[model samples]
Target: MTKPAYIAITQHTKNSKPALVYVPTRKHAGLTALDLCAYSSVEGGVAPFLLGSEDEMDAFTRGVQDETLKNTLKCGVGYLHQGLSELDQELVTNLFLSGRIQVCVASSTMCWGRLLPVHLVVVMGTQYYDGRENARKDYRIADLLQMMGHANRPLQDNSGKCVILCHAPRKEYYKRFLYEAFPVESNLHHFLHDRMNAEVVAGVVENKQDAVDYLTWTFMYRRLTKNPNYYNLQGVSHRHLSDHLSELVETVLNDQVWADFR
Candidate 1:
């Protein structure tokens, strides 16, 4: 078979509404945006937003010190990631949402509840680093679904497109995984200490029992409660509850001043 091009462009929208290309890492996202911009046409001009008039676009372009990013912006492609400043992020997001930018290349962090009416979502990979697992892992089906959900806007007449590009080895994996919907697993354990500290400091929970009560109201708690078998918890037993509480309390006590609590 003939080798394919490094980058491919597919058009789904007639008006060039914003589209997202999701890469696995910040570096990949930046490189992809630069590649796309460098390969694409000037007719697909960049969008720069300023509080004032069109002249501000020139000013904004001049202000960007990164020559690569500045040039990419001129080509109507922008990259977004946690590394970018809040102002830069907002500028890219606003321009994309307003249909001024044709494509926004971003890492998977962009998928978390930041709704952009993108006409297409090109997911470049099926794996990401999992800090909890201490290794890279394939994305769960639920996460892929959530990411794909960003492609389509309910208000739009035309349905959006989600394309996942993976190596041949993982092709069957994605097929099987995406064939059926998977329920999202709880991740509250990751945030237990932070939530506990905030609730205690805010006086929303006075005691351990109050903390448990507050947690029970969370979606994670409800999922655990409803599907105890799935979690292997064997029901919301006192032992399991205490184990969770102990973990949270230990984390908080280690990081915070106990005397300040009173």
Candidate 2:
């Protein structure tokens, strides 16, 4: 992955376009950034990925607290993870967008929340271990898409590219998912009863119609017609949707949680 990332860094740097690399964890983000930096360094010293003059590089690292991070930045590499302060995240992000940084390696959970003008994006790995689940989970489909999406810069470049590194068995899986449009479905129904109970207690919802009406204002309601079968609906008519919601409301009101409200 780093070999490809190294190639991307070298190529994109020549075009004056930023590149992005997505890793699975905070530790991976830092290490990958430094590894890429070293790949382009001169005689074991940080030499590639750096931007601007010595004085400018000196000023860039002056207030940065992490010594390794400071050095990485001098090499024009930045790492971001969920642990960073909001201000620090913003600083690194701004630098990347403004061409002050050549490459940024970020963890899956650390989305920069901005449209990047990068020409290359690399997904170093496809799975991360989840402590709570006690297992390794594939990167969420949406997250993988978002990470890859950064390779494009609408007006900045004529084209963009993304390299995805995953286990051999999962290559087909990613090819199918990434090349196809993955639909995003709402999960609001999973916790609708709890939410309905709260609104009922707060006098925001009174009966079945009120509950159904409340759902109409939610994203799930908007998707009813689009994915009626996913929600277990036999028909996609307004009446059918209303009947389902009414049934749901009745069921919720009978649950142990809503007993007191009734």
In terms of TM-score, the best-performing candidate is: 2
List the candidates' TM-scores in order.
Answer: 0.59, 0.68
TM-score, structure 2 vs. true: 0.68
Shift in Å, residue 149, candidate 2:
2.3
Over 104-200, each residue of candidate 2 has an lDDT whose tens digit, in order, gives: 8888876556566588888888899999979999988778878877878786788888888889999998888856877778888899877987898
Poorest lDDT segment (10 consecutive residues) of candidate 2: 42-51
Writing each residue's lDDT as its tens digit, candidate 1 over 1-262 gives 0011123233454555566778878878778877775455432433321122345455656766556666666666777888877777777777677655577888887678467667677788779888787998887767788788878777774687777887799998788776866577887766777777788889998876786677767787768766776655654877886676555656565566654665
**Residue-level error in angstroms, candidate 2, position 262:** 8.6
